[model samples]
Every structure is written in C-alpha cells, then in structure tokens.
Target: MAQVLEFKLPDLGEGLTEAEIVRWLVQVGDVVTVDQPVVEVETAKAMVEVPCPYGGVVTARYGEEGSELPVGAPLLTVAVGEPSAEPEGSGNVLVGYGTQAPAARRRRVRSAPAGTAAGTGPADRTAAPRNGHAVQPAAAPATAHARVTAPAAARPQATAPAPAEGPVPVISPLVRKLARDNGLDLRQLAGSGPDGLILRADVEGALLTGTAPARTAEETVVRTPVAPAAGDGTRIPLKGVRGAVADKLSRSRREIPDATCWVDADATELMRARAAMNAAGGPKISVLAMLARICTAALARFPELNSYVDTEAREVVRLDHVHLGFAAQTERGLVVPVVRDAHARDTESLTAEFARLTESARGGTLTPGELTGGTFTLNNYGVFGVDGSTPIINHPEAAMLGVGRIVPRPWVHEGELAVRQVVQLSLTFDHRVCDGGTAGGFLRYVADCVEQPAVLLRTM
Candidate 1:
C-alpha cells in the first residue's frame, strides 16, 4: 500500500510566521530521500534550503514557487507506504517532528538532553558507534558545544594547549586550499580573523617573514573597468535573491490594494539631531537610525498599524512589541532585517543592532531568526533624494513607510517665507486591513515623531 503523507511547512525558526517559496529543488513524482534539500525558502533576509524529513516520492506540490506560504501550511504530498485517505495520526508525523514509529526496545539506556538527537544526513555526519551496532547517536552537532568522540567507556587524555583567541580562524576553505596548493606557511603569518582568526592576513604575514613566496609585479596589477559596447544593454539575470524580490514585488502590486498617503515636513531638527549623534559617536549613526527610533515610538501610539493581516482567519494579528524591519539595499537585493523588539532598545543599542543587521545581511550571514517576524517596515528613499515614491507593501504587513529625500525648501515661518530642510513621507497600506483613518493616523504619528526628535525620548 502506497501511503500518502502531506508534509506541511514547519516553523523555520523564531517568529517566522511565513516564508516565500524561492525555488523547488524537486518536482512532482521525484523520489526524495530523508534530509534531502527539496526546496529553497526566502524569508526577508536570506534564502535557506529546507530538507525533506521522510524518504518518499513527491506526490504533489501544494504551493508553487514564488508563493508566500504560512507556517504549517501543506507544502507538498509524499507517497510513503499508505494511501492518501489515511487519518492524520494513525502513523503519520507532523511537520518538524519526525515520522511516528513504535518505541525502541530498551535494553539499559541513558538519557540525552533536548535537541541532542543526532541527525542522520549528509549535512551532519556522526561518527560510527564503537559497539559495532547502529544505536542511538550521542553528541549531535546541531549546537556548537557538541563534539565528536568515542563511547564514554574509552576516552583519550588531552595533550595540546588550546590556541588563544585572535585573528587566525577566519580563513576560508578556498584560501586554505590555495595556501596548501602553493605550499604557503600559514603559521608564520598574523591573522585577520573575526576575533583575530588566522586568515589571509596570516598568509600575507608569512610572505613578510620570508616563509612564503612574495607576489610578482604581474599578480599585483590592478585591472581597470572597461566600458561596455554601444547598444549592448546588460541584462543581469534576476536569480536567487533578486529573482525572489521581483516575484514578491509583482505579487504585492498585483494582489494588494495599496493606498499611498504623502506628507511634507521640515527635517532640519532631525538632521541636526543626527549630526550631533554622529559627532558624539560610538558606531557611525545615520538618518536611518533616527527614522528607526521614531518609527518604534510611533508604532506604540498607533498599535493598529503595527500588525499583519491573516487572510485565512480574516483577522488582524496585532503584534504587542514592535519588530521594525528596515529595507536595506544590498548587492543581492533589498533585504529586510528585523530589529527584534525595537521599542525595548535605546538609541545606542538600536544603532549597534542596525549596523550588525546590515552587516549580516550584506555578508549573507544573517540567522533565520533575524529575518523573520517583522510587524512593520521602513524604507529610506531619502538617501537617494526622492521627493516621494509609493513603496510596495511587504506581504502580511498592513503597511510600509517610505522616507523621501530631505532638502532645503522655502516654507512659511511666522508669516515669512524661509528655507528649511524638508522631506516627503509616503505610507502605503493594504486597504483591506487598514482603513483610511487608521492609515492617516499612523502616518501622522510617524511624521510627528520625525519632526519632533525629542518625542522619542519622552515616549520612551
């Protein structure tokens, strides 16, 4: 009997309510093994490959690529050993949890902590058991603390003193391969590791110490940028992150009824505040920092705006804490890295976190959690000096705020025309969820906060 098992999309990580289907690695009717990457999902930040939990043939794909699916929604149907009509729990397992099976016959067993079960997959390899029989695995490497070792009965004594911290571990596999192939002395060089791990710096250091070959003049030549041929418009393929962005933007424009409202305000005070903060600096702060802080405070006053619409439930899921996501333009595409509990953070912490988030996003090192669960989004078009532009609403969220360029403009001050730094604000909302009144109020609140920088401190 060929059983049909419906595999629902599992929760990728913390606060990830939904994911955008980036690509399908396997087509329908394709045989997939347990832990094989069956699909790729893009959650605001990075694209992650989702593996199959069970070995079976893919019966049907429930959702198409480029579709935004909620967590626990049916992703695909797999034919295991039973028919599709089988009940949910007769033998089937839920998403994230493995398949249901009878309890293992216990001999004399020991216990393991949570998330300690070793995964039997190519992504993670566990050392074979010394007992010569396949048994429960020990020391799963999911966590950083996990170490591969022989059975507890047989252990070796530690001999070497662990290497001290500093730049030495940051060397990439490619760099290591290059060094080995070229017979470079890695130990002779100083490292430029994250915390000072031995990286290319150490390799260069070896050359300085006469332990490695010095680069030839030909190898040190800098290449100049070439002008493209006339009428040859370069068409970059929108694949991976860029492709995903296009799909989402198209979907948002096509599906959501976006209502955009614009406001012009004096940004002289906000600009001054940013200048003062930059002068006093720890991390180099920008106008984006002030906008983020203002948005955090404003969301509190207009909680209805800081929410996502659940279409299935036809209810507005208002988030209690503000997780403000910023639209950062990266080489890959636009990535929205969520600042978890933005309301709880101070100016300094928020600035630092923003820097970390942008760094991680650009470096392609953001964790699953950092990209998920954004209540609201802020896009700074001001950097490019746009007066106002209608921004696409990030799906699920009711609205997205766009900040336009702040330039000196003539305005009335005490019955006299005066020049002041002014910027236009654009707020686009999903009309189905948020009414005109709610949207207007939210924009007004945000504009007020930005216009009066002191309101942020008072609100906090």
Candidate 2:
C-alpha cells in the first residue's frame, strides 16, 4: 500500500497571496523526484518553477495551465511508500529555502490494476521495465471529482462521463466561473482536452453553438467589471504584472500626497567621465549605474528622502541603508529590480548588479525578494528617449528619481554659450516624508554630480 501525499503551492514569499499556473512539467503517472520542478507559475513579481517536496508517482494534477490558484491550494497529489521500487527522496527544499543535493534520476512506478485508485491495492497489474517509456494501464471509468491515471495508449479511446450525469472534467476555476456566469451546466458538454478536460475553450464553444443559453438581464450577476464595455475595444484583463502595477499606482495616488520637482542639468561631464572610465577599462560601467551611484550619494546627503511615512505609526521612518531599485521595462511590464545595500557598492559592482537584474527582469526570472525592499528608486526613462515624466512614487517608498534623455543642447558653459549634453531630472516625493527643501537639496546634489562627476569623490 502506498500513502498518498498532497502538495500545495508553497508561499513564494514577499506577501504574494496567489500565482497563475504557467506550465505543467509533469503528467499524471509520471514519477517525480523530491525538489524536482513539477510546475512553473507566474506571480505578479516573476516566473517561478515550483518544486515538489515529496518524491513519488504523480496521481493527479489540480489546476490547468493559465489558471490562477490561491496560496495553500492543492497543486497535485503524489503516491509515496509501498512495494514501489523508486528511490526515496532526500527531503531537500527549493532554492532560498535550503540547500539541496542533486536529485537522483526518476524511475517509473509499476502500474497497478486498472480499476484501482492511486495509492491503494497490491501491485497486481503488469509491471514494465525501468526504461523511460511509460507503462500504459487499462482504461477505467472517469470519476467526477478526481483525476485518474491511465496509460498513453488508453487516452484516445477513454470514455468520459456525460456532463449531465457525472462531474465535469474541468481543472480551471476560470472555466467553471465562465460556465456559471452563462448559466451553463458543465456536465452536459463533452470536453475536447486530454482525458475529456473541460477548458475555457469548451465553455466558449458551447456559447457560440448556442448549446448554453445566456442568462437574462435580471438573472445576470452584477459585479465590478475588470475590462471595459464590449463595444469599446478589446479589453485586456488587468491581471498579473500589469494588474499589480495598476493597483500599486492607484493606491499610491490615493494615499500619498506627493510633489514633483524637475531640473535641467549638464551631463556632458558625466558622459565624458563614463567614456574615460570605459577607456581605462576593466568592466564597462553603465550610465544607469552611474546615475544610481549618484542617487545613493544624494540619499546619503539628504537622508529624509530615503524614508517612508508610516501612516499607522504616524511617524516618518528614515532608513540607513539604501536598497536601490531601478526601473526596467520588459515584455511583461515595467518591473523595478532592487540592488541590496546599494549605498555600499562601488560603481563597478552597481553596474554588474544592474546588468544582472535587468537581464533577469527581461527573462522574467527575478524572484520576489529581488523585486522589492527598496528605500529609493532610480527611473532612467532616458533609455526610452523621453524628456521627462513625473513618475509615481513606488508605494511605501519615499521618492523616485527620474532621468530623461541626454542630448546636446544649448547651454551657458564658463559664461559662453556652448552645445553641451544636457539631461532632465525629476524627483517625485511623498509630501509627508519631507518638505520641498529636502527633495530640492537631493535633486540639486544629483544635478551637481551629473554636471561635475568629480564631485562624487567627496562622498566616495
């Protein structure tokens, strides 16, 4: 007899409450090793490969790809212990949780009798070799509430119960919600997905074919709409990263009394300094990294801006260490990846970390910790060729410094009109954190450093 264990999505940390399933790495009946990635999920912060802690034959998967499941919800069930010959797991944890040794190669468990539920009965069915090929078992009648494992050969001919008679083979909650909203009985329709799994498409297809009648206006449930009117245009659901950004920005606006200050600065010296550094070369420093270094220096000078207003405590808390956040735009959306203790890192280290974080942001591999805990933010909108933007302060943080495109512009240099590389800097600060004097002093210090890069030596 094998003991069946259920694995739920672990808390991925940083206050995240839920995640959307991106892909399934294992199938029912596949043997999985401990700490092996069983599924990939996308939280608002990043894409994460969730590993199963228990090693066993996968008995059932609970959700479909693209489905959102709350934390602590069942992800899958694994059948462990028994007359099974698979190696026992080392009981190691995922990255950041603890150290884990290399997992042993996965071996398939011998299939049990056709009608036996997983984790039950003796090994009476035909046993297959330890080769990678899957063992196909005889097809059994599908159950309404549980997913049954069968051999690949039986999938094509498997008969699913009628929707009107048994539980519908549906995995996604969104599909169930869609059916409910349209007053459709899921049990009546035959699913087209594997093992007769009812998908969103199946429900949608039934609607198009007029198989399910639309609810009347009076019967329709009224709720806050996520998207706009149907005739307006295509409505993208405000979910995932985009939704998180929207909610944060909205809350920042609602709660914070913020003020913006802007200035034009000569960045010719900063550019020249960067060129000289690169020419002297070990590792090429990025302009964003230089700007970040300057921001850290400025924060050190005006520590008030490096603080957040604790509304519940009715006090402004100033932080000592700078966890510098830099905004990077990716296909997913705008994400701010933070560099820890940035005030303590040199320009070279900052450049390397920025490059690493930016790459991770682009690849959607940043962890929740990497994306949060910033005391200050550096927004280099200059990369986008924009002149200026009054950026919204990342909530709970005191201020964000926005840098715009640096281009040759007319400016007075040494009392003579000359073409100099000029850039626009804007500081958005929470009014409650500090007065305009503090914000202005910080921006002015940043501008001075940009105009004269050597001035950074005093802080260094």
Candidate 3:
C-alpha cells in the first residue's frame, strides 16, 4: 500500500503571516525524511531553512520557487504510500503540522530590476534613429547563420604621426582643500606629477617656497563652519527594527491598558556578584544579565504576569514555561531575542544564553526563533545611567521590566545614613491580567532578588 502526504508552510513564529520561498532543496520524485530541511524561506530579516515534518516520496510540488505563500498553504505533495491528486480542504498542510500539496513547477524569474518603469518594453535598437535616418540595427557580430569575414592585411605604409599631449589633469577636491589651506597657487605649481596630476608633495613644494615649514592640506590646520543646506533638516525614513518597534509600542499603548509599578533596590550585592563572576570569566556577564535572571525568577513566582490577555476569549492563559525576551540595542535598531524556557536554567546557563543572544543580535545573526516565543521581557536602561524607565511590553507578552543603572545614593542604613549602590526597577504589565497589587508584588520580588543576590538561588 502507498500513502501520500502534503507539506504546507508553517506559522513561522510571530505573526509572520506569509513568506517568500527562497529556494527548494528537494524536488519531485526525491525521497525525504521527517525534520530534514527541505526548503529555504526568506522572511523580512532572514532566510530560514524550514524542515519537512513528514517522511514520504515527493509526488508533486504545488508552488514554484520565488512565489509568496501564506502560512497553512500547501507547498508540495508527497506519496506516503501511494501518489494521488490532493484531497479537498485537507491538502493545506502546516509545516510541522500537515500534508504537502501538488505544486506547479516553473523556473523562478529573477527579481524585477529596481526602478524599472512600467509600460516601457525591453529596449529595441533596430528602431532607433541615427544620422537623420531610422537605422535598422546591423546583425550582432556572432550568430550561427552569420557569415565570418577576415580582414585583408595592411599595406606597408608610412608610420602615423605621434599623438599630442592631452590636457593637464585638474586637482582633486581633497588636493584643492589642501592647496588653499597651504596658500599655494595651483596654476603656478607645475606638476612634477605624471599626466600633470597634482600630488600632495607638489602642493607642499609650492608652500615651502618661503620661510617656515610649508603645509599641505593634510598638514594644514583650517576650520570652516558648515552652513545649513536649502532643504528641510535631516529626513530619516522609519524602517526595519526601529519602525517595527515604533509600530509595536504604539499598538501596545492603544490596545493594552498598561499600568506601571516601581521599586527601589540596593544594588551593592548585585554589583559585587557581577564583579566576582566577571573575575571567573567565561563570558564576561554584566548587570543586565543579573537583572534578566531576576526578572525571570520573579515571573516564575508570579505566573499571572507570564500571560497575554486574550481579549477575544476574555481570558488570560498563564504560561507554564518561561520565554524571556531582553531588549538589545544594535546599530540597526532595537531588537528583543528571547531565552526560551528561562525558568529551567540556572544563573550560569541563563547568563551564557543572554550573552549569546545579545552577541548574535549585535552581529545581526538572530534567527526568527530567537526573536519570538517570548512570554515576558526585560529592558535595561541602566546602562545609560538612568534610574528607571517604563519600557513598552513586546506585544503578545504580558509584561516588561526596565532595569536602571546602579549608582551610589544616600539611604538610611541601620541607624545612620550611608551611601549605597541603588538601582530602580520599573514593571509595566497588561492591566487586564495583573492588578496593581500583583504587579507591585512581582516588581518587589525582582527588587528583593537584586537587593540580595543570594536570594535568587532560593527563589529559583
């Protein structure tokens, strides 16, 4: 007996919705195993290699390469036992979830040339104008039916006269800037340079004509105030992570009625722990790592905060596992890479994971997986020496905690006033799932853990 299965595009994390097929690794008539990478999909940020979740003989391919397909749409059909046409409604397989459809095969076309004008057909030189005549183009030099002609040898003729010397080369902008600063007349300076090109040495020679050392542009000290240009000031187009962050933050603000709870903490012990840990040095972990660790621990203590408010269902599903997303600043913009199941890991593991995520993020190596599945988030503004800031929650995550810088501040210690390293924690939660008391307590738990680093072990 022969059976067939179809593979469809899976929900590629986040609300990706759709993806463009970059390339197909397997083709019809090829045998493939379950979980083997069969196709490469290009999303907005990366080209993710998606694996086949069902083992079968590929029978038909439904979509061609370079086509955009929605999640849950059939990609290809495979014969699990026998080949057959796709069944109604059931052929739409979810990657890791269903059967592939019989895809149509077509050679993928290259992307359209950027800025190509619509309605303008491919250029035809045959109809072009030349010398007041509509000239039909001469046949291209090499073709199968074209005649091959060889030129006759040149007669023993007189040698042609030598070519005249061309015009002198002009000075470059940098060279001119250098010359002006050096007070050298560019014209009077006969270039000792080849092809009359002015070299920096030539400019220096002109300046050195008098006393005191002559200076070339490189050696000159000249400063000029830059004038404002005619257009409106710098216009920055919002796109990529920065644009995504703005959109998300706006949505979170509008949809989720958010409330914040703040807590002050003595970061002396936390700072000491960080220094000691860095001394042992595997991955030089920082205060942010410790803060992320504390945030995860606090979320574990309060599962209510680890849930998203389902407005449609009118319910909050508290997650059983921890997927903690941390805010990272990169040259591209802000990104949050999640540490999946963070509650299962110890401080060392968590620190290593956080370091890995941040390094990958900064290097722009983060896969869509690392950017999604976050049930909670932590954003550290402490690096900028701020006391606290209310970071917007990464949408779909219930809450986000902001960690501020650790600085020495006066506080009553025992009976007398003393300087203590203090940092602030700002917790912003979805008001629908968390009340002020719950939110406050959850923040207080994190603050307590940071205040006493040893308490984290017990909490974990």
Candidate 4:
C-alpha cells in the first residue's frame, strides 16, 4: 500500500502571505524526485518554483492555475513508499517546509452513494479518497440530452443561471475586485471555470457585452479610478512589484519631510577620466560606477546624509558601512539592487558588482536582501534622457542622489567661452537627518568631484 502525504505551500520568505499559481510543472500520476519543482507560483516579489520535499508519485493538486492560495494551504498530495522503487528526498530547504507531517495511516471516509457525487457535500468532495482512487460523479442522462438539443449560445446562457443561495463561486480576491471595480455582481454570472468557479474572463466578458449592471451613484463614487486607457483600457492589478513600489512611495511621502537641492556639474573631466580608465583597459568601467565611487567618497565626508532616522527609538542611526543601492528598471518594474560594503570596493570592483546586480535585477532573480538594506541610493535617471527629477527617497533611507544626462553645453572655461560636458545632479535628503547647510555641503563636494575627478584621489 502507498502512504499518501499532503504537502502544503511553504513560506517563500519576506513576509509573503500568499502566492498565485502561475503554472503546474507536474501532473497527477507523474513520478517526482525530492526537491523537484512541482509548481511555479508568482508572489508579490518574484516568480518562484516551489519544490516538493518528499519523493513520490503525485496524486492530486489543489488550487487551479491563476488562483491565489495562502501560505500553509495544501498544494498537492503525494503517494510515498509504493511498491515501485524511488529515491528518497534529500531533505534540502527549497522555500521552507511546514512542521506538521501527514498521518501515519490514512483515514477512510464514507463514500457518497452512486450517481449522487455531483450533489455530494463539500466535506466529501474535499476529502481525498483512500489509495488514490478518484471519486467521479456519474454522468446525468437528462443533462446530456438537454445539452445536445440546446443551441451553442443557449447552452452557455442556460448553464450560467443566477445562484439562488450560498456564497459566490469566485475564488480569487483579484477576480472579486475586478468585478467590483467594473460594477459586475458575482451572483448573477455563470462561471466558465471548473465546477462553476467564476474567473476573471467571465467578469470581463460581461463588461464588454454591456451585460454588467451600471453602478449606482454611491457605488460609482466609491470605486477607485481606473488607469488611463488607450484602446479598450486593460487594467493591470497593482499587486506584485508595481504594488510594492506604490505602497513604499506613498509611505515615504507621508512620513518623510524631504527637501531637494540640485547643482549643475561640469562632468567633462569625469567623462575624460572614465575614457582614460577604460582606454587603460582591463574591464571597461561604466559612468554610473564612477558616479557611485564619487558618492561613497562624498558620503565619507558628510556622514549625516548616509544615515536613517529610527522613529521608534527616537534616534538618528548613522551607519558605519555604505550599502549602495542603484535603481534599475526592468520589465517587471523599477528595483533597487543594493551593493553591500560599497565604500570598501575600488572602481573596478564597483563596476563588476553593479553589472552583476543589474543583470540579476533584469532577470528578476534578486533576493529580498539584495533588494533592501541601503544607506543611500544613486538613481541615474540620465539613461531615460531626462535632464533632472526630484526623486523620492527610498523609505527609511536618509537621502537619494539623482543624476541627469551629460551633454555638451557652452560654458566659460578659464574666462574663455567653450563647450563642456555638463550633468545635473540633485540630492533629496530627509530634513530630520540634516539641515540645508549640511545637504548643500554634500552636493557641493559631489559637484567638485565631477568637475575635477582628482578630488576623489585624496579620499582614495
């Protein structure tokens, strides 16, 4: 006899409460090894492949694809210790496993009478049958006859009659929100999903057809405003990376009293210095890395900008090491990947670290640790071709430095009018951590370094 074991979804870290099932890697009856990925789930952070801890034959899967399941919900059940020989699990931590183990012996439940499986109670439907036996309802002859005679349009219409009682069949909270946002009532629509499970498509279809009821004045007033539409206006849920960014930025605006100070720096020398370094070449250093190196030097001179305020303790905690975070925009969203101990690394090392972290950010493989713990941020919005922006401070951090494009502009060099490569640098600092004078001194030092790269050598 095979012992069936239930595997629940493990905690994927970073306080994730739930994950949406994106795809199923394994199916029922498929033999799987320990730590083999069974399903790919999308948390608010990233897409993660969840692995099974026990090696066995997959018996049943719980949630449907696109359905969100809370942590600790049963993901799938496996039959272990079968007659067929299979290797045991290696007991490695993939995500993180639950402490509870499956029962040593399987409990037998009373089977529903034949032909009544469709009408069976929820408890009977949810319980797994002994020995991996499938509990299927017998086909109803009358239902088949009615379906064959009904027209295609009539069939869908008839199948989806309004529910008389009980809760709605919708499973995803997102689907519910979508319906509520569009003023579609869940009780009226027929679900196209398995066992009348209302899906997002069902609600969307009702909206497109104008079948969804119009919202009352009160409902319309309460509904959140939708994003600007180009064509038919597709709504993207702000749940994953986009949602996190929204929440953090909103909080930063609410809590931090930040001020911005900017200076136009002559970056011709910095650009020339970069060209000389790359020409002397081993690994070609990027302009962003050079700016990051300058940032660390300036922070060393003005440590107040490189600190955070601890509200709970009522103290300004100045950090000893510089954990530099740089903003990188990818298809997922804008993510700040932190470079640990950046103050200690040389320009070459900084370039390499930036390249590695940027690659990880683009690939969406950055861990929560890499995405956090920054004393200061260096945002190079120059890549976007913008001149300048008063950027928001990444919350809890004291300040952020924004860099604009370096372009040749006419300037007076040594009392002679000439063209020089110029860049605009802006520093947004938390007012609580420092006053205008301290912030001005920090920006002036950065500008001096940009104008004459030799100033960084003194710190070096």
Off by over 4 Å in 1: 1-237, 278-284
**Candidates 1 and 3: which is better by TM-score?**
3
> Which portions of model 4 show Cα errors greater than 4 Å?
62-67, 82-91, 94-214, 221-232
TM-scores of all models?
0.52, 0.74, 0.54, 0.76
The count of backbone overlaps in candidate 1 is 16
User: What's the TM for model 4?
Assistant: 0.76
**lDDT score of residue 36 within candidate 4:** 84
lDDT of 1 by residue, 38-117 (tens): 88777644767676666777765655676555565556656565323222332433333233321111223345446665
**Candidate 2 lDDT, tens digit per residue, 1-460?**
5555556667777677767888999998899987788998888888888888778888767677877666655677677775443334455655432213322233244565465567432221222312432233334233332343332222332354454555677757878987776577787777655556665656666666676744456555352143222233443555678878988999999999999999999999999999999999699999998999999899888999999888998999999999999889999798999999999999999999999998999998898889889989999998898999999999989999999999999999999999999999999999998899988999999999999999999988
Q: Write the per-residue lDDT of candidate 3 for residues 1-460, one digit (tens) a residue.
A: 3444445677776556556676789976789876677787655443567777667676655445755555655566454543233222233444332333333222243443454332211111122223322233253222222211111110111132112454434344656776555454565555433234454445544444442234445434352223121132553423345656777889988888888888888888888888898899686776666777787778777889999988898889999988888888888688889898887876778888988888888876578777878899888887776787877778888888888887899977678899999888898899999789999889888888887889987865
Q: Output the worst ten-in-a-row residue range by lDDT, candidate 4.
A: 145-154
Write down the worst ten-residue block by lDDT for model 3: 148-157
lDDT of 3: 0.64
* Candidate 4 structure quality by residue, lDDT tens digits, 139-244: 3223221111111111243365557888887758978988776677888888754456675667767776767766677776666366111225564656667778
Candidates' RMSD to native = 19.3, 7.4, 18.6, 7.6
Q: Rank order by TM-score, top first?
A: 4, 2, 3, 1
Q: Looking at candidate 4, what is the lDDT of residue 190? A: 84
How does each model score on lDDT?
0.64, 0.76, 0.64, 0.76
Q: What is the Cα-based lDDT of residue 454 in candidate 2? A: 94
lDDT of 2 at 18: 69
